[model samples]
Target: DAGVTQSPTHLIKTRGQQVTLRCSPKSGHDTVSWYQQALGQGPQFIFQYYEEEERQRGNFPDRFSGHQFPNYSSELNVNALLLGDSALYLCASSLALELRGYTFGSGTRLTVV
Candidate 1:
């Protein structure tokens, strides 16, 4: 009955560095999605994973990639970070293919210096 969980609560990085944020989906769920929420903005979908494969992707660049494990846990990897990348990175979970009724974790706030 545990909900989605994310790591590091907060992070600070410099431009051109890389960062990895993690997530564990809720029980009985098979899909994990990553979203980027700028301050005072709704989350914009980054990508989705199901059946151990990426099923859908957003308009982000190649710098944004993710993986979903067999246990339905996931990770979001951002490479060559930019000052623009400094934002709250959120991880969301859903059952099967249901994308709307998502459960979100408290995100990892990344600040690029």
Candidate 2:
């Protein structure tokens, strides 16, 4: 019954550093998607995972990656972080790829100094 949950609700990093953010999908959800939301902007899809494989990806570079476990939990990793990468990383879960059924987490706010 719990909603999607993301760890390290807030983080501060420096350029060139790498960061890994985690998320646990809601009960009965099998798909996990990651999004990046900059200040005053809408969420930008990063990628989506289902059945432990990446099913779809956004316009982000290869440095942005993700994984979905058997338990439906997921992780988002950004390598060689840039100051422009600072934003709210959101995790959304759903029974499938249906956007209407997605449930989002509060998101992990990343600040690159």
The numbered model that scores best in lDDT is 2
lDDT (tens digit, per residue) of candidate 2 on 1-113: 66888999999999999999999999888999999999999999999999999999999999998888889899999999999999999999998847558899999999999
Models 1 onward score TM values of: 0.95, 0.96
Model 2, poorest ten-residue lDDT window?
93-102
Candidate No. with top TM-score: 2
Where does candidate 1 stray beyond 4 Å?
Answer: none
lDDT of 1 by residue, 1-113 (tens): 76989998999998999999999988887889899999889989899999889999999999998888889999999999999998898888998757678998989999999
State the TM-score for model 1.
Answer: 0.95
Checking candidate 1 for backbone clashes, the offending pairs are none
Worst 10 residues of 1 by lDDT: 91-100
